[model samples]
Target: MEDFALEHINDSRRTILITAQLADSWNDRIKEIAPDFTIELRPWAKAADIPDELWENVEILFTLGAFPTPEQAPNLRWVQLYSAGANQAFTGPLAKSNAIITTASGVHAVNIAEYVLTTMLTWFHRYHQFGSWKQEGHWPDEHGRDLFMPEELRGKTLNVVGYGSIGREVARLAKSFGMRIIAMEQRPDHRDRGFLFPDIGDPEGKLPDHYYTKDQFQQALAESDVVVAAVPLTPDTRGMFDATAFHAMKESALFINIARGDVCKEPDLIKALKEKEIAGAALDVFADEPLPDSSPFFGLPNVIMSPHISGMTPHYNDRVAMIFTENLRRYLKGEPLYNTVNKERGY
Candidate 1:
C-alpha cells in the first residue's frame, strides 16, 4: 500500500466525490482549497445509478443532504457530512464501515447562538404579542401608559442541556449579557472544564456551580430560569423532554429547544404550556418539518415557533464549506478532526 501523505494525496489529482447538491459558492470554495483535485458532482439520482467507477477512484466522499450505504461505496475512505447532525446517515452499513466520518459541527455555532438569543429577547420583550396588538388596534392601558412588561436576562440562570459546539456558543453569548450559565452533559469528565464558555474570556473561571448527569437533570431544571436544549436526537434523547420533565421546571421558567424536535414530545410540551407548567417556550425545530397547519403551537400565545432555522444565516453555506475544506486537509494529514461524534454515543 502507498503511504498516504497529505501533500501527495492532495497533489495526485485525486477525484473528490460529492454526493448531493452543492451551492455554487461552496463548490467554488472546494476547488480553491484543492485545486489539483478533480471535483465530481453526483447529485442524488436513484441509489441504483451511483456510479461504481466514481466510487472506486474517489479519495473523499462529501455527503450533503443524503448518505450512501457502505455497500454502495466500498472504496470510500472518508465521509464528510455537510450538516451538523449525522443521525440520518449514521446507521446500518455506514455505521459498520471503515470510512472516517466527520460532520459540520462548529460551523453553525455562532448563527445558532444568535438565533437562541433573538428568540429569547423576542419573548421577553413581548414583541410577537405586541405586533398582534398593533394589528388588532387593541392597545392596552400599559401600551399607552409607557409601561412595558420586559423580562431581564441578567442575573438569571441559563441551564444548557448539551454542551456541544452550539451549546458552547450559546453559553458564551448568554454570559456576555450578564447571565449565569449552567451546563449538563452525559460525560462526567467535562463537568468543570468550562470549555463551553472559554470564548467569553473565561469570566474569572466561574464554572457552572451545578453540573448534573442525566439522572440529575430534574434538579437542574428546578433551579434553571431558562432551560436550553441543545442535545442531539439520539435513542436516549428522543422524546426525552416529556410531561414529567416540563413539569419539573419552575413555573416562571422559560424553555428553549434548538435541538432536534423529536428530543421533545410536542403534545407534552403543549400540555405543559396550557397548564402553566412553564412560563413560555421558543422552539426552532419541531417533530414535523414545516409543522402541520393543525399543530397547536401555532395558536399558542405562550410559545414562539420558528421553522427549524435557528442555525441558518446568509453566510452559513460558506462557513460550512470552509469547515469541510479544512477538515479535508486534516483528514489527508492524518490530524485529529474537530467535533468528531461518538458513534456509539450517537453525538
Candidate 2:
C-alpha cells in the first residue's frame, strides 16, 4: 500500500520550490495542475542563490541534491526526490526534516532491469573473453571450438536478491526468456506495493515461482544460476552479502549487482572471484565510484565492472516528472503518495 501515515497540511497560498533543470512544458503542466499555488523554478547553483523571502513561502521542494535548512524553509513539508535510490535523500539537511519524502523509484526500473539482462547474457556466453580472440585475429580450431558455443538462458533459475520495482521488471524480462524466477523480499508481498510503472513490471508479483525472506538468505543464493542484487542499501543491508553468502551459491553461478556497492564486501567478493567461489560477477555500482585505479576488481578477468550507471536512459527525467506530477495530484487531494520513503526502513 502507498504511505498514508503522513498527515495533510494545507495553506491558502502554497509555494513549491523546484531546483532542477525542468522543461518549460513540465513547469506549465505543474501550473495547470495546481493553478492557485505559486511555483518557483529556480534551478540555482546553490541554496544561497535562492532568495530568503522565497524560501520562507516554500511548502514543497523537488530536487536531486539541493536541500534547505530547517530554518530556511519552515513551511517545507514534502520532498520529491529525482532518483530511484533514497540513500542520497537520507543524507544532508533533508534527513532531519519532517518532510514526507517520495522517490522516483519506478522511473529507472525499466532501464536498470534491461542492464541486468544484458550483463547476464554477456557473462553466460563469455562474450568479453572473445575480445582477446578478436585482437589476435585468430579463430579457435575444432579442439577449442566449444569456447564459442553460446550458453542458452532457457530453463536457468534467476534469484532476485531484492524484489522491488527494478527486480520485478528484471523478473518480467527474464520470464519471457523461459527462466525460472525466485525472489528474496524484505516483506511478505503477494502483490506489488508502490509506484508501478504503467504495465511494465510484475505488478501482481506472480513472476517469481518462490519467495524467500531474509531468514532464508543463504538458501535463496544457492537456488540460482544467476543472482541479481537489486536491493536497497539500508543499515541492515550494508555488507550483507559477504563470504558466507557468496559461498552459498553454486560454483558456476553468475552474480550480478545493480544495487549499491557496500551491499557486498569488496574483499570477500574479490576473494570469491579469485577462488572461483561463484563463476563471475557483473557489477554496476561500486563502493567507491569511478572505481579507484588501485582497485583489484579491474584486474579480475572474471568480473565485469561498469561505472555505476545501470539506471540511465534518455527518457529518465520524463518518467521522474510523471511520478512527481502524480504525487502532486495526490498532494492536492490529501491522498497517500507513491514511493514514499520511510526513515526507519531507510529505503
Candidate 3:
C-alpha cells in the first residue's frame, strides 16, 4: 500500500472510509446522513490493506486501529474511532492534526458498569471461596458457614475517579444498591459533556455525595469503601496509582479498576496486595495484556483479574453505530459533534 502513495492527488470533496468490521450494516446509515460523501466500505484488518490512493479524498475515517498519517490522509476532517477511549488517537500520528476526533464513549458504559458491580459483589460475598467448595462437592461446616452474612450494599461510600460516562453509570447503579458516591474528577465538575444513553447514567451529576478534585484524591481515597478508577489513559493519569496512592486508601477499601491498566503501577499494586495495604482488588485492564503468565497478579489470591474484557458486549457495534450515525447527522448540519476529544484534556 506504501508503494501506491501519490505526490499530490487533490479532491475538493468529502469522502468517508468505513474500514471497521460490520461496515456493510452501517453503510446505509452513513449514506443517509452523508449522501454527498464518497463512501468506501472497505473492511480491512490492517492499515496496510488500505491503498494510499484512497486517502487523497478521505475526509472521514471510521476504524478499529487502522490509521493513515497526516501526510497519507491530509484531507482528513473527522475521525470516528471504534473504541470509547480516544487515548490512542490523541497519542498517535493524528495528534498534531486539526481533524475532529470523536469516540464510541457511551457504548460500553452500561456493560463496564455492570462488570464493576459484579466484581464488587463477588468480593463482598466471598463467592470465589464457595466456588472451591462446589467444585469438590463439599459443604462447609457450621464453624465457618454463614451463608446469610447480611453483608449487603448499603451505606458504603464509593469513590469514583474520573467521572465520565462509565463512572456516571457506576454511580447510578451503586446508588441503586444504597451506596453513597464520592467523585474525584480531573476538572471536578458534575456536568457530563460526552455522548450519553438516555436515562442510563447520572446525566445531571446529582448522584455524588461529595465531589473532589485530583488535588484532594488521597483524602477521597481514604473515605471510600470502594474505589473505581475509570479515567482515560493519558499523560496525567498514567502510573497515577503508585505506592503512595495505594497507601493513602483505607486498608479495608476495595480497589476496582475497569479503566486502562497503565493507570496503576502494576508492581506497586502487587506489593500492596501482598502486604495487605488494601483489602482486595478487581482489575479488568492491565499494564501488560494477556497479563504475562509470569505476572504476580495471577498468583495473588485476593486479586480478581480478567483479560481486559469489562467493556465487551454483544451490542458493541450496535451502540457504536448510534454515536457514529448521530455524529454524521450533526456533521451534515454543521452542528457540534458528540464525544469530541479535548486536545488539552487529552481524552
TM-score per candidate, chains pooled: 0.85, 0.96, 0.93
Model number with the top lDDT: 2
Model 3 segments more than 4 A misplaced: 1-13, 23-25, 146-150, 187-189
Q: What lDDT is reached at residue 68 by model 3?
A: 82
Deviation from native of the Cα of residue 337 in model 2, angstroms: 0.4
Which candidate comes out best when scored by TM-score? 2
| Cα lDDT of model 3 by residue, 1-347, tens digit | 00111122245576899887664667787787777788888776567887888887888888887788889988888889998988766666768766778888889889999999999898888876678689879877887688525367799899999898999999999999999999976544577777877888887789999999888988888888999999989999999989998999989888999989999998899999999999899999888787889988888888887898888899998889888888888776677788887778777
The 10 consecutive residues of candidate 3 with the worst lDDT sum are: 1-10
By summed lDDT, which 10 consecutive residues of candidate 1 come out lowest?
192-201
Candidate 1 TM-score versus the reference: 0.85
Per-residue lDDT over 69-107 for candidate 2, one digit per residue giving the tens place of the 0 to 100 score: 889888888889887889866788887888788988888
The per-model lDDT (C-alpha) reads 0.75, 0.86, 0.84
The Cα RMSD of model 3 versus the native structure comes to: 4.9
Q: Cα-based RMSD of the predictions, in order?
A: 4.5, 1.6, 4.9
Better of 2 and 3 by lDDT: 2
Clashes of each: 0, 0, 0
